[model samples]
Structures are given as C-alpha cells and as structure tokens.
Target: MNPILSNLRNITLTYAIWLMIGCLLAALLVLTNISLWANALLFAVPSTLVFGSISASAYYVARSLPMKKRSFFVVAGVFGGTALIYGIIWGILCFFWNKITLLFDESWAGIEMNQHLASLLLICGTLLYLLSILVYDVLLALDNIRQAERREAASEMLARDAELQVLRTQINPHFLFNSLNSISALTTIDAAGARDMTIELAQFFRQTLALSEQQKIALSDEIALCNHFLTIEKIRFGKKLQVQMRIDPDSENCLLPPMLLQPLLENAIKHGIRDLVDGGTIELSSKVRAPWLFVAIDNPVDTQPSSAQGTGTGLKNLQARLRSLYGDKSRVEWRIAEQVFRIEITLPLERS
Candidate 1:
C-alpha cells in the first residue's frame, strides 16, 4: 500500500489542497482563453485526481533515499521516473477527453488545444510531485532522529546495570572473608558461640542472596539486612559491640539501591569499632525531608593511629555507586572530630 493511502487523514488533507490548486489552474485556463469554462472544469477534475494519486508514490521514493547516504544519482533517478510516469498518464487522459469532446460538439472540432497550455499543465503536475517528495523527506529525517535517541538511552541503561552488578559482586567477597576469619578464631575457645554464629551467618547469607537480585529495595528491608549483619558481628564482639538505631517510620518505605548501606556499616565496624579497645557504640539514623531521604552512621574512633584503619576503597565505591544511580542529586560525606567518626548520606526519596 502507498504510505499516503495507508493514512486516511493525510490522503484526505492532500486531496483537499490539490483540489483547491486544480480550481485555480482551471480558472487560469479559462482566463487565457485556452478552453471554455465548462471544458476547463472537465479537464481539471480528472487531471487533478490522476496527478494526486501519482504524487503519493513519492513517499516510497523518499523511503529509499536515506538521509545518511543520499546521492545525486538516486534523487535524480526518482524525480525522472516520476516525471515520465506523470507524462504518460497525462497524455492518455487528454487524448480521451479531446475525442469525447469532439464527439459531443462539432464546434469543439474546430478548436485545437494550444501546445503551450499543454506544456504548462505537465510542468505544474511535475512540480506538485516534487513538493510532495520534499515533505516526506523532512518527516523521514525527524523519525530517524527519534529512533537514534531511543537507542542511545537504551545503551546507557544497559551500561549502568552492568556497572551496578560489578559493584554488588565486590561487596560479597569482602564481607565473607572477614566473617570467615572471625568464625575461625571462635571455633576453638568458644564452640557453642561459634556454632550459633554459623547458624546466623547461614541465614544472613540466604537473605543477602535473595535481595541481591533486586536493583532497589525499601529502606526498612535494607535496615533489616544491616541488622542481620550486625547480629553476625555481635557474635564475634559480644558485649563490646553496641548498636543504636533511630529510624523515622515515615522514611521506612522509601526505596534505595540494594546493598547500599552494608558497605558503610562494615566500614564503621572495621575502622572505628574494631580499633577501639572497649569496642564503642555504632549509631544509625534515617529521616525523610520531602523529596530527600537522609541517613547517618556515627561510631567512636580511637584517637591514636592504628594499623586497622580503613584503606578507603569501600568509601570510594559507595560514592561512585551513589553518583551512578542518582547523578549529582545524591551524596555521601564523612567527618572525624573529637574521637567520633560520622558518615552522612542523602538520597532522593522514591516510593516503591
């Protein structure tokens, strides 16, 4: 099917405009005394209908001439082919109309059609066909631009997903190595405690495996995962490791990237709590402020320098992930003062 005929509205609009042009051309023929008013009307109507249908074939030609690889030969070939077809159709129609007029009136037999007037009609039809092709070319360009933009957007999304998967994979091994080391030390001196920690460790890993498949989860679920992790750590630290949580109920349902908080919590325990001889408190807090969700973790740090100080990889990874997921709208910041280390993070509040 022709592209123009495939769309009823477009065909209707094109025909209406062409009909107006036909009326104008018919008036010109009459004013120039090339034909009687009645004869001009009879000629213009059929000619316009035939030319309009032929012009619609320009859409197919436009489709063949892509913007990226358009050439002079291809364009010229299309217009040349169209003009030839139009001339053949116009000649045949005019011959039949002339013969019919001669049969109807002996007075028409004396009047021969002017050669200049015939050439003028052919030129007008060819120009109309060229204009139609130009319109289709512009529309084709816009469609190509839209399709290119969609492909770019899809490519970016795939890259982000791959990066996020790599970041998530990095977290598991780091935490697993530390957990296994603690379990190894406890097996000989405290068999029962080690056994209980093993049970909790198994459960924690099961939950982690389930949640890792998701790209994002509710704040409450993330906190629960962190608490499970703390439970396993508490088995190793005993009464020395204390945790304090102040979570806002309203912010519990806010969504964030999965495994986002665990690395921060791990960093606090490794750098701050583990270095202190007494094993100080870790405080976690979360709140919502309109479009933003705020979360903070505070832990007591030893004033004196220790060999167990973090190498900054975890913090850097957290910052990178935050930037990738939320662009510049989300952030992570940390400060150390008065033997206390505080890390604060801000993220856009998105509901599930």
Candidate 2:
C-alpha cells in the first residue's frame, strides 16, 4: 500500500496539491488565449485530478528501485519509460474528454483538441510524474532514517535494563552474609534479641524481594526498607550505630531505581561508624527543589588508619548505575574531610 494513501491526512494533502495544479493548468490555457476560464477549467481540472490519482503509483516505482540499490542509468531508464507511458495516457484522456464536451455545446468545451494541445499535455504529464517520483524518493529516505534511529534507541534500552539487573543482584549477598553472622552470634548471648533480629531480617529480605522486581520505587518505600535494614543493623551494633533522617515531605514520593541507596548505607557502616571509638550517627537527608531531588548521606570515620578501608568498588558501582539509568541528568559525588565522609546525589525528580 502507498504510505500517502494509508493515512487520511496524507491523502487529503495529496489531492489538495493536485487541485492547485489543475487550477494552474486552467490559468495557463486562459493566458495563452486557448479558451475562456469556464471552458479551460472544464477541460483541465477533472483530467488533472485523474492523472494525480494515477501518479500515486510513483511511490511503488520508487520503492522498487530503492536509492541505495539503483544505478543511475537503470533509474533513468525506468523513470523515463514510466513517465512517457503515463504522459501518453494523460494526453489521450484529455483529447477524448475535450471532444466529449462538444456533445453538449461549443461554450462547454474547455479546449479545441489539436496536435499542439496534445503535445503540451503529454510534456506536462511526464514532468509531473517525474516530480512525484522525486518527492516519494525523499519521503522514503526520511522514513528509513527514522526507523534506524528507533531501532538504535530500543537496543540501548535493552542494554541498560540488563546492566540494571546485574547491579540489583550485586546489592545483597555480602549484606546477607553479615546479617546471618550477627544473628548467629546473638543466638548464644541473647536468644530473644536473636529471634527479634531474625524476624526483622525476614521482613527486610521480603521487602527487598518485592521491590527488586520493579524498575523504580518511591523514596518513601526505599526509606521504609532502609528502616528495616537499620533495625537489623542496630540489633547487631547496639548503641554504636545511630541514624538521623531529615527527609523533605515533597521528596518522599519521588521515584528512584530500587536498592540505589541501601548499598551506600551498608558501606557507611562497614567502613565509617564501625571504626569510631564512640560510634556516631549516619545522617541521611533529602530535599526536592522543583525539577531536582537532592540526597546526602554522611557518616563519621575514624582518624586513625584502619585495615577495613574499602576499595571504593561499591561507590564506583553506584556511579555506573546512575550513569546507566539517568545518563547525564543525574550526579553522584563523595568526599572525605575532617573525619566525616559524605556522599551526595542529584537526580531528576520523577513522581507517580
């Protein structure tokens, strides 16, 4: 099927152009003193419209000889042959229609059918068909470019989704191992605390499982998961670990990739608070400023050198995940100064 004929808008536009061409043809006949306005229009308008309908076949001809595969000589031969054939057909139609008008009256005839008039019609028909071929060729080229862009975009999306899945899976195992160890130790000293931690651990893992299947989760849901996580950590660390949350009401419902922040919290505990003699609080704050959501996490690290300093793999991974998800629209940065290690993230705010 012709792409132009496939849509209502395209079909309407095509006919409108052909109507203008018919009017132009009528004007030419009058200007040359070939016929009066009424007679000229009667001869040219209907014939031009019929020619225009047949000219739509130019799309199929252009498709058959695609620009990439066609040779200059072959294209010239094919186009010239079709245009000449259509031109003769159009001249015959005009000649017959002009003669038929005489059946009514001389005033009704748009033009006096003659050899000169027939030649003019043939030339015009050939040129118009060739022009149609050019237009269809350009349209097909643009359509091909658009399709290539769409395919590239889809491929990138699939690759990003695959990377996100790998990142999501990487978030758990080490934390699970540590939690199990904590629970195992607590069982010998405090049976009730161990049972409580067991329950909290179960709930945390259940929530993680639920949210992991999603592409994104609300900030509030992530906070709830973090709270469950903090509970289990508090049980293990006792009074050594403390948390301060300063979350803005507006930012709570903003959505981010699942497990995006939890790994950072795990890193803070494993490297920062656990090293301090009089363990300190981890500060987690978030605020929304119109189109942007800003979040920061700060924890106190020991001044004395320690062997537990991480190789920054988790932070690097977090950065990679941000890049994959948001491209350049999101940012992640971390610095350690004056025994305080802080990581901040900025993201485009998305809400449901």
Per-candidate TM-score against the hidden true structure: 0.87, 0.92
Tens digit of per-residue lDDT, candidate 2, span 1-352: 6888999999999999999999999999999888889999988899999999999999988888866778989999998899889999999888888878877876756467777778899999999999998899899999999999999999999999999877766667867887898899999998989999999999898878888888889999999988889999898788999999999999999999888788889989989888888899999999999799999999998888598668877888889888998999999988989889999999999995
**Cα deviation of 158, candidate 1, in Å:** 0.9
What C-alpha lDDT do the candidate models reach, one value each? 0.82, 0.89
Q: Tens digit of lDDT per residue, candidate 1, span 1-352?
A: 5546768797798788888877887798788887776677667766677677777777887787777776788778876677656665665566566667667675433225666866776677667677878887787778789999999999998998888778777878898988888899999888887898899989988998878888789999999999998998898899889999999999999999888888888888888888888898999999999889999999998888586556798888888788878999998999998999999999998988
User: In angstroms, what RMSD does candidate 1 have relative to the true structure?
Assistant: 3.2
Clashing pairs in 2: 39-110
lDDT of candidate 2? Answer: 0.89
* Residue 170 error, candidate 1, Å: 1.1
